[model samples]
Target: MEELDFFKSPDEFPPRRGGYGLVHVDCVGKRGYTNSALVNLYAKLGLHRYNWLEGTNFELDSIMKFNMRGAASPYYITLVACLPSSGLQQIFQVLVEEERLGILDLTCPISRPQGTESSKKESTPFLRPHSEPVSATHQDRLLGWTKSVIPWPSSEIGFSDTKRFYMLNESELQCDWISLYVELAICTSHRWFKARDLSNFELEIVQVAIESLHDKEPPSLKSKAAVIYIAYKDLAKARTGEPYHYQAVVRRVINEATGTLSIQGDCWIAAAATA
Candidate 1:
């Protein structure tokens, strides 16, 4: 599933040598100063991750107030997201630390954010996160052997099936996991921060597959859950950026020892590499 920083505080203390200082930015009003497109992207991405893991469908309606503090790389963003399903909203905070294409800290989208005194308490999140009890395993298998990987499993609560790979029905591909995968497929494929020309181009993914060793009882080695995604980089947003297909192996960091179903970023966008 897709999930979700640091910046200096405009309202806080001064920075020291080799040190990061917590920031407190002053907002104009209840809406805060978080109207940037990138900030909006982060809010949506975090909600996407939350939906899959919690088994709830909370769409982002709008962004309320937010506080940020960081220089460039790892930015700590605390934002309140309004859900369309319910007028209420949920407050989320995260840490971002990736160079090329990045997501928030693995430990982010913190179930509850600090100072939860929003106009809409936990109305958005409180009504969601309804995952059924699972014995163990991932609903979406990251292990490869197939040309496509079903975003979520229908029958099994967990991916504890003895078989290494399982097939998914066409109907089952319409879950939040698919959105998470697609979002990941696009972002993870473009990890070149220095490549300035690639930003405006569009992206497409196909032959998506996954490979993992975390299935069995006690499983095998820990190689981090990986998805072998084939993406097309179109230099033109007209869907003709040279459909160069290559494998994009990506992973999400979760705490296996505790058996938590959510995409815990031990800190988002856990691992990315080209093969």
Candidate 2:
């Protein structure tokens, strides 16, 4: 009904009693999603990702209908989309994950909706459906890992379980977008960046480690089941461009029942000693 942005806190939303209306359950199974705003946004996101990966422009025509299942963030959605080029509407299943930082990770799988047999025969000028399991080699192809070189004592090698801060050398930090997520996290409603206090943050991310097992983590970080610790060297150019080392603590809250995710960030910044 109103303009929507990624900034809204999902947890704060007052629960709706029912969906817009009960739609027919043909093949895709899920409760109807009432948010018309999200209906357009999520559908576009799904199509955007699909077009990017498949190199096909099956333009979004209108938000016909939407259904959300799993009751959480990474929702499996089925919607109708038509190609502006041909006005042929097709059903597609999309996976959309709402991140804590208000970012979305939407993906489209390779499948023809509404009975693959019939749709395959009816749908015209197909893309040949070059499908591959993304999860099968997702890490091997896109992500690179180095394994943290931080040498801890053998006794402190790792927690009895992965319940404590374990070294993570996940090198996804080199990308500009991942760096942007960290940048947004640094502005966590704190006044530190106001009045030109700590602007021009140039970060050289040094390490990415994760900690679990709530009991051993900080009280604030313990709010979530797991934590991602981003260690980096920063330059506050608004000042003297002086370098400072800080570890920003990122907390992710996941609703296990619905598999929805919410994230918050915090950091304790201390300047590097005078050179």
Task: Quote each prediction's TM-score.
Answer: 0.48, 0.34
Per-residue lDDT tens digits for candidate 2, residues 150-210, read 2222444633444455554455556333343365455433313431332345778876655
Question: Residue 254 of model 1: what lDDT?
Answer: 36
- Model 2 C-alpha RMSD vs. true structure (Å) is 14.6
lDDT of each: 0.38, 0.43
- Candidate 2 regions with alpha-carbon error over 4 angstroms: 1-163, 175-181, 190-201, 214-224, 236-243, 271-275
Model 1: per-residue lDDT, tens digit, 73-187? 3335555655566666666654333333343222232333445332232223432334333334553223331222323333344344425443233444334443444444444
Clashing pairs in 2: 100-263, 163-212
